[model samples]
Target: MPGGLRHLGEGTAAALARELKEELGLDTDQLPEPPVLRWVQDQTTTRPGSTEPFERLHLIHTLNVPDSIRSRIATTEQDANDTTQVVWVPLAQAAALHLYPAIGSVLTTPAGTSIGPVELPPMVDGTYRWR
Candidate 1:
């Protein structure tokens, strides 16, 4: 999504939960324990359509989808604005796409300030980690 931080009020798990419920109408209880939370920083100074200074610390939450629920889930407008787009791409293809570098070093060091030319992690089974 373009303005994920904005959509997530105060940037808390509960807020995210509320957002998900309002946006996608997905029940958080259907999700598994301890959703994957990744911390990222948007170091870029110049962003499109904004005069306010930017702060990093973008947290991305990855929720597991049950096979049954996956089939029922659909992207809403909120999801689109909060996320770029929801696509069903294979892990191999997704891995080949250029993703933000900060996503790469999450398991290790914080990735340097850069975007693009980075491969995303693979999706295993039906669960995929979000960055």
Candidate 2:
């Protein structure tokens, strides 16, 4: 669930593998294929008090991981001093939570509506602090 921007000339799959090692210390040898890009969000926003605008393109990947592996990775330390607490929320209740990029929109939609990529609206006012 934790990843970073790919290095110059580095493939997405390779970058993902490297990120897993740096973030959760997970080994990807067991996986048949690398995680695929699920969501791509392009956002432009100004930090709480900043007058200047910040623009970013975020890519999200999803993988089918074993429960044992998930548990182990969730407890491990991640990159960039990230202290994100991973919690599993049922889809039925996820819509009510504060999810970044408001992924709830997709989760709340009915199946078979879209087949390919989805674009999410920009994140609104919020404060971010990395621990």
Best by lDDT: 2
Model 1 lowest lDDT segment of ten: 122-131
lDDT digits (tens) for residues 1-131 of candidate 1: 21234452365666766666656666777876545554444343434466664444455555666767766655544555555444555444544654443343343333343342233343231332223
| lDDT for predicted candidate 2 compared with the true structure | 0.66
lDDT of 2 by residue, 1-131 (tens): 36577899998778888888887777776666557566677767676667787666777666667777767774645665657665666666887765655566566565446665566665544532212
lDDT per model vs. reference = 0.49, 0.66
TM-scores for every candidate against the unseen true structure: 0.53, 0.69
Runs in model 2 deviating more than 4 A are: 80-82, 108-114, 124-131
Give the Å error, residue 69, model 2.
2.0
Query: Clashing residue pairs, candidate 2?
Result: none
Model 1 vs. true fold: TM: 0.53
Q: Where does the lowest 10-residue lDDT sum fall in candidate 2?
A: 122-131
RMSD of 2: 3.9
